[model samples]
Target chain A: MCDSEGSCHVLLLEDEPMILMDLEFAAEACGCNALCATSVKQAMKHLDSERPVRVGILDVNLGEGQTCEPVARELERRGIPYILHSGDLDRQNETVRSLNAQLIPKPANANHVISTAMECVGRKCG
Target chain B: MTDDEQERSRPSQAMGNPKDFDDSPERFRDENPDARFGGASEVLFEQAMAQTRMAICLCDPNKPDLPIVFANKAFRNLTGYDEAEIVGKNCRFLQGPETDPEPVRKMRQAIENEDVVVVELLNYRRDGSSFWNALHLGPIYDSEGKLKYFFGSQWDVSDVRAARAEEHYAREMARELSHRMKNMFSVISGIVNVTGRMRGIESEAQEINDRVQALGRAYETTLDDASAGRIEIGQAIRAILSPYDVGESHLRLLGNGIRVPFAAVSSIGLVLHELAANATKHGAWTRDDGLVEVDWQEKGEDEQRVVEVTWREKFGPKVTIPADAKGGSGNEIIDRLLRFSNGCIDREWHEDGLVAVARVPIWKAS
Candidate 1:
């Protein structure tokens, strides 16, 4: 599912600037190109890009009452697997429960996080 | 002192507070309640009801609109309505626009069923100020089981409701703070990750991130249950070790009920994570058939109370015991972390694998 460099294009969705930077670096380290989006609008742009997104890592809460559910649903529709990297992981949260992606709780190893998303390539995520 | 001043200094020995007696003319005005019972027992009961601080009201069901026929002095003070203004009006005058319709509906149904109903609702006073009213309404029947009147007791529970609201607010604040704390940890690790990439020290940065994540996971164990909101030593151990678990026969978690102090959870997590990584590199996890068992328990009583945990591995090649094993960096970390928390550990290189025992002090048994 990857090119000769064991590389793929990954969508990195996070509102926090520093965390986005880390995810970008992590994606690059795993030998993939990162398409970083700070807002849901930017995320949809990445999803719409012709270059195509092979996998994704999403943040749950985006502040100001926004969430990653819409982006996750679009990714699920495309059959592109994504991982949920959240600071506050509540299984009881109906939105999070319905998103149904693999969860790697926050403050986790950055490289480990991106590489796991790499492993999710071509797998059913929703 | 004058005679009036001397009498004012003395506690009132009247049958009841003279002020209450002066305000309550219901004994003379309301004949419906007196008709039901007219004995010494009824008189004594009336005296107690008249003097009590609780607001009491009796409404006659037989009257048109079921008007309030009897209201004690406290009821007048609570509603700011005198006998002239309150006696003929229905009890529904206390309800305001903000009052919830559900409780009102429940009260109506209870009255129709002739059952007792206890409700708390927003009630307004004659002065237009609102207070939470904890009201108990029930029917008072005669010897023949025919309902005579409905007695209502009211208490101002504004302070109680406010305290409960404050508790709910505190829980929300705690949840928000915990959410931010998790994000801060991630941001910190993110900084390390990006900086490490720029400095070409990605591996070292990952080691630091692993430690940070262990701390986060430890804190998360407590966050899961907001009520107790305390981490069990075994739960913290299982969370940090879960990442290293590679399918079957990897790690076994065995312990329950024994908890770690709130402050020491992260330290214990780091200590266990470091030791587990060490074992993975050179101990049991290095072998294909290897297994690691992490067990936690509480031992001793009273002054000797301590939380003891053991991390033992098996089915790996044994290595030579170093002469400077006591001075190793692993033990130094374990020692320092535990010492700050008033705890200690013992490590041994058994023939099969590495074994370490940690004893963390607990101020109070949990």
Candidate 2:
């Protein structure tokens, strides 16, 4: 897609180490560049660096008992579309669920995760 | 002492000639001041002791048998022994199979050490009836600093202890019931989520979630009404069907308000939601041309006020009643709902429309 680098910059905000690895490989395989953050604070640092990011995939819950709800709210305010990735959508705390985002459950197929991310980016950027 | 002579002569000294020996009150007082002072006090003390509910015993400390020098009516009533039977025996006769040994042992140690003892035990009554007894015993000393006697009192407290236990059980039951209800709600939410995913599209899935969430809300609102022991049918129907309406005009609501019980409100609400959802998808409200007319009125005399809710469809696409589709599941839920209220459902089909009629009782709120 590009001369010698990735096609587009993708930011992923997932907490699990294995899930983060899966997403990075999936995004790179889809001809997109990937930047990973394990928490909302780290994601904000990445966003502050003036890097061009076309899309985001946000894990709704951080394993350390924190939530990405405020991060998702900030993304919505910044006009950046994000897809929700959660394994505990039906079982997690109710307050975190009231946020607005398209939800995709996990241990999801890598292809569906990548495609949903692309679709969300296309909806926001186009 | 000749019996006939003693009977005849006794009246001569004490009863016959009181004026001959001590006619003047001043002379009698001068001869025996202690008798006048002590007899009056002793009679008053006896009167007060007889009226007390607390078991009172006066024990001789010098005697190891602890022979009871005095026992009140309450003591006789508590130990099943009258004055003649108990006055010469040890006060420990009250201890038996029903008596708790720990407090009794502590009480004996306290008494041997000349310390006041306040402890709980089980003591037998006159009829061998056992009761929880709170015993308080203290030593009484004479002016010469010698231990004169021990005074003991017992109280019955079985009813108070039983009432406390009952109260504890009630609170435990309330907490357990609340916990169970919360888990139940979570399980229902899980079912809604899983079922929503199996639907055809996102909108359909969202719709199902919205309706199911509304069902959860309806259950809450109806529970409030049920706790108050009355349910307003019109208010309930408006709340139950709100998710499916989406501010549409083809769904018309017509009914005067009627009150029923919690069971009726819940059962009827489940049945109505099923029918309304089916109608929204297949019968009326499926197309712009279709219409649903809902109405309710009294159907019988006396206490039998039949409230009929009709779901009528007209001018829709050529309709085929899904005999196995909505009918089967909907009827099963409806039957379960009406089992307690003695209700039924009737369906009729004509060339132009399909109609469902639910007849339920107007159970009065208590």
Best by lDDT: 1
lDDT by residue (B195-231, candidate 2, tens digit) is: 4444535345444544454455455445434545676
lDDT of 1 by residue, B68-105 (tens): 87777678788887666777789999999999988899
i-RMSD per candidate, Å: 1.9, 11.9
DockQ of 2: 0.04
CA-based DockQ, model 1:
0.62
- TM-score, candidate 2, is 0.39
Candidate 1 interface RMSD, angstroms, 1 decimal: 1.9
Q: Which candidate leads in DockQ?
A: 1
Query: What lDDT tens digits, residue by residue, belong to model 2 across residues A1-126?
Result: 122344677778877665576567667667777889999899888766666667778877675668787777777777777887765544354744677678875434444677888886563221
